[model samples]
Target chain A: MLTGQLIAAVTTRGSGASRVIERDLLVTRNNLMVFVSGFVEPVFYLFAIDVGLGRLVGDVTGPDGGPVSYAAFAAPALLAASAMNGAVYESTFGIFFKMRWGKLYDAMLATPLTPTDVALGEIGWSQLRGLAYACAFMTVMVVMGLVASPWAVLAIPAAILMGFAFGAVGMAVATFMRSWVDLDMVNLALLPLFLFSATFYPLDVYPRSLQMLTQLSPLYHGVALIRSLTLGTIGPGLLLHVAFLAAMAVVGGIVASRRLHEQLLP
Target chain B: MVARGLTKRFGELTAVDAIDFDVHTGEVFGFLGPNGAGKTSTMRMIGAVSPLTGGTLQVLDRDPATDGAEIRARLGVVPQENTVDEELSVTDNLYIYGRYFGMPRAQVRRRIPELLEFAQLTDRADDKVTVLSGGMKRRLVIARALINTPSMVLLDEPTTGLDPQARHLVWDRLHELTRQGVTLLLTTHYMDEAEQLCDRLVVMSDATIVAEGSPRELIATYAGREVLEVRFPPGHRYAGWTGLDGIGSRREVLADRVIIYGDDAEQLTSAVTHSGVEVASMLVRRASLEDVFLRLTGRRLIE
Candidate 1:
């Protein structure tokens, strides 16, 4: 009987996820420009870092501690950051508007869809968008000769994992927001992570204390994981980064779903 | 649907205070109340979205606490606000809402045209929902609620912001749904709306039900068959109210007018005029649900 109830719950959530995706598909179909627009921000950042900033910074130390072009070193980090950005933007601002102003979840909850379904469905959509951005950024990386090894193909899944981790956590944070002003706090948290996660320079440039603090950021794990994959620096320590991100995804997803159930159901 | 001692408390404040009511299948049941009178709260509980704080409530013979998803699966809801998907077209809004209910794409496609026709939105089917008039949007919302052919539909102030023409159009569509054997539960402050649409209703005031019955029954009980209104000039205190007392069954003195309730309005008017009350104007009309609401609550239905 317990298993039967569990299966029933799973099936209901599965249907809810599909329903959310279906609604997003309709929204994207109508506003194709907005769907296409998400691709532009990451590309702009990639160009700004590689062409503008790289001219001044020149070469940096790669994962193997060997000298590599500044663009080559920053490309994978940008890809990781973009995956994070795509997921966070979609899950935070996107879900906030729908939940608060649009009351979209209210309408959905009036149907058979539960709040858990909404969280899962939104996270799924964000990952899908993050995957697309990751693929585009990866292709650009290859064309720029940033791909140092065939193992870089594994970076796509790593990017997806990165997306899921950030997306889940972003959604959990969004459930607590009460007004538009609270959104600035999301930016406040994200900007430092993007700048300090070794995206613009190597972690060795910072003091030991600051470097340790940098390692504590979730984006630091994502950047290190993808950078090692693309730079072909395969080490057993990479498992630690992947495990950290995987744990974040699981815990954050559970928290987001539970918080959504509490807020939307009441 | 049945609710016994149903209560909703938001922190220390009670929104719905131990209300008892029952809604049978295929009837138009109304929750009539002014703003903040717990009508929306009660409707939300019946819709299985808001958890009941205290009481026994059953919808479709299932408990909403444990079976909200199941109860919602068989229910339709039109919220007080326009929760339509503004970014999507009219067709897409209905299509996606249907999908939310787990309807198959083919079935949703088949039903869209029929729903559009019902809502009088066939001509604007491909237009974005943001451009539709207030009335058109409301009609589309009503049509979207029927996408599942639900066993029951809950409308929270279905026509609160709509103009008269739009309101009539929505009422016509709702009436059609009732004729087709759909159970409807709606909340409204408009006494005329309640009298026109509801088979039976409960008047709510200050978080509790003040009265419950058919519109005519409540009007007949709380107010007489007709009301005589007499407005003397401002600041004129008529000492002749005792002479006008026997003309009607009961009399209510307002700041602007004196309302006399009686079985016969014409006789009461002549009697009031004959009493030499020096009235500025006198009018007699049939007693309505508004009178019933006012007499029970000591407050006007709208204000």
Candidate 2:
């Protein structure tokens, strides 16, 4: 996992982040509704699009330019968005409350854990949640007969990668939040991405300028990568999406660690 | 712990100016000062969590700047805030905190029961921290700090917000830690708490050390042996009373009382009465660290 590499990237004392994950696991054992609830939103979107809208919309052009059912086209993008949400929700609201109210990082820093450990540990937890949502969503995809090819199996890891990118970036954003009132901006930023990042429709539906703008959304790369994998449209062009997500994850991780060290230790 | 010209600055504000001190092993050391006297800042530097702005400092024989995690591994920190995991059980907080120091699972498990007993939270081990009272939460934070079996412990205003009974209980627990030879470094503005807990203390005033020694020594060197308190009626101009001056080594005239500091309170009180000054009541009080701070800084500790 990238978490192992991230740990070595910032510190020699990386076990502290694992300890944070263990604490989160113990806390989550009480209110599993949190995870179930996060997993439900995208499923609802998937069902609404598949059952209600797919009948009216008919087939759409897939990545291979072949005609495919609307459900089939939207399913992979839904999975990618869900992965991003699972991680972002965990990193944003979760980090905000724990840092400001719970004072968990203040306690951890008093021990041997560096800010890098706390950052990666929190991201690692979100990534796990994202993975769970991805797996469950994939299972649903298979049961619904939405999975197109054997390559769809690779979507799970690709979904986790999406989670890491959004989760890291979300954490970096969360560090800048000052109060609960500041949390409204998270919704402001995420709702537009959820609606406009090629999640519900193909990028072709947009005008030329809007389509170009949509590509700038990080979630767009996530959706495109997962969609390519699930559609079995194998090509070297997919490397661009991977590079974007990876770079986002690295930059986000660095900024988050640096910002957190300033706040927690300053 | 050793600090030489340690300093801390926040933008244009200097929280802790150049100050120096040494903490001996196996003793209860205290930073005695009012709010914003640089006590917590110094404590943070010793905790290895806050970076010092200037000067040389060492904790546990290691430089905190370079070896923070390693230095922190051997140290326990009870921050001023109640930093316990409100969502977790009392025992889970301890287990997870011990794991933060990389303690083995089995060892942490074995240590938990004894620690709960030490903290007097054995019955509440499975309870949520939010359900516990503030005193119980304070005890839990203290117990959690001990999970690593640290050689040194840093407590920032440990009993600041506690009620009298809770404060006494916390003091008792600290006494036990000192008896076990854990090097405890604490901060407080309460003279009684410092007198009860600290073997040696430094009086911090305006971001610098005004005095340092044992509690008795600070009282003797700065305060003297006893205080002669002369009380009068409300709105009385007691400061204009004749024969009040030159009766003792020093004199402090408050709104309602005149305090005469001297080695012999009996003679000072007798001299005040013999000078035809009307006194409603008189009492000889033992000198305390509060008086020492007031003498050095000319401000009340709690005010």
Candidate 3:
């Protein structure tokens, strides 16, 4: 009987089919259309700056003293931003709404589904969404002649890593949410991370103290790693970026799982 | 199933005081109480969904605190509210819930068709739950509970908010499940529901068991075999009838109705009439679980 129950829980949509079903649900036309629409925002920013600001600023020197357009410089960072936004939307608002208003988690808990199952399943689904956004954005970059080398292949995993980190942290924050009012506080945190983490500018543009502060941000690691790969400027510093993201993923997964256990199981 | 000195405290409120009750296999045990009577709390503890504050509870011969997952696997829970996934179709709800118990797809596929018929949802199997009527949704919940064919089924106020027709449908399904030898435990505010369904019941009031026995046994013990209700004209007080000799016991319900309890309502009504009480209205009826509730709680069960 115990084995029967376990088999049922594992195969139940949460098993494998549900995992695929969940991710498939997130990648529907509306979500894909929204993602494509969001891609236009950053691409428009690139076009506006490269064409509009380019006429004023002229061609800028790459980090390696090569001729580089402003559009090219900001492309990978925007891709990283897209991945972060996707992860945040999925892990925070989507999760919080389901947990609170939708009563989805409540329904799951009534059965044998544990909080651990929810955390794993949600994180897994978020990762899949992250991949879709990363791959789509990367394909666009290639179409726009932004690919610098085979190193860009690494960005796929990097974007997924960024998403994993943000998704886990988002779930952790969602557990502490008391009301819809708290969602604004999440925006307050996410916006600052997006704006000041060197997504559109070089870290060297800031003072040494400010530069060090920006490095502490998870998006900074994501931006540095993806920007280097897309610009064909791989170096030893990329390993540090990978380590930083890996630590975030591990820590975030643990924290989110623990918080979910306390919130749901308690 | 056994609970010894089980208690639950939520913050400063004591929801369930220390109480002991045993549910034997293959019998329907009910917890009958008014709202705030701690029925849900006790059921939650037994279902392995809530932790006990003070005492031991064992379901399927396993302790809930340690064996929650294991015990929960063998139990089916139908909560008071409709917690069925409204987004899913009727058949999908059963299939998914069956999977939650780790049942394989092939087995669930086999069971889903039968469950849909059993719940009488064969025609609506493909319809989303949100579109179903109140009774249909409740039947679907019961059907979901049976997907794994659990050893015990826990229901919390299963028929509340349902119309009489819908309530009877759910009752019929429950009767069928119990007839198949599934141990059933449920809580309800309906006296007739408890009397009709439960083989044994615990009458609870203010977080404690006020009485416990079979429905008829409880009625005989606390309220008697029959009850006589006597009413008089407006402004005519029952002051003269309170300690009347030869009447078994009497209770005034509002200013109009006076209940007289005894073994024989005919004898009691004749004696009251002979005593020249000048009654304006009278009803003699067999003592029901409601009278037993009123006798123990000093109030009507519904109010």
Fnat, one value per model: 0.85, 0.96, 0.26
Candidate 2 residue pairs in clash (backbone atoms < 3 Å)? none
Put the candidates in lDDT order, highest first: 2, 1, 3
* Model 3 pairs whose backbones collide: A5-B101, A7-B102, A8-B99, A8-B102, A8-B103, A9-B102, A10-A15, A13-A18
lDDT of candidate 3 over A154-203, digit per residue (tens): 99998988888788777778878888899889888889988999877778
TM-score, model 3 to reference: 0.86
How high is the lDDT of residue A21 in model 3? 44
The TM-scores that each candidate's chain B achieves against the reference are: 0.96, 0.97, 0.95
The worst-scoring run of ten residues by lDDT in candidate 3 chain B lies at B237-246
Better of 2 and 3 by lDDT: 2
Candidate 2 Cα outliers beyond 4 Å, as residue runs? A1-14, B238-243, B274-281
Model 3 lDDT tens row, B269-288: 77887776666788988889
Ranking by DockQ: 2, 1, 3
Candidate 1 C-alpha lDDT tens digits along B1-303: 889999999999999999999999999999998899999989888888999999999999999999998999899899999899977999999999999998899999999999999999999999999999999988898999999999999999999888998899889999999999999999999988998899999999999999999998999899989998888766565654445676789887765777899998888988887887777888889999989888998878775
* TM-score against truth, every candidate: 0.94, 0.95, 0.86
> Top DockQ: which candidate number?
2
Question: What is the Cα-based lDDT of residue A15 in candidate 3?
Answer: 62
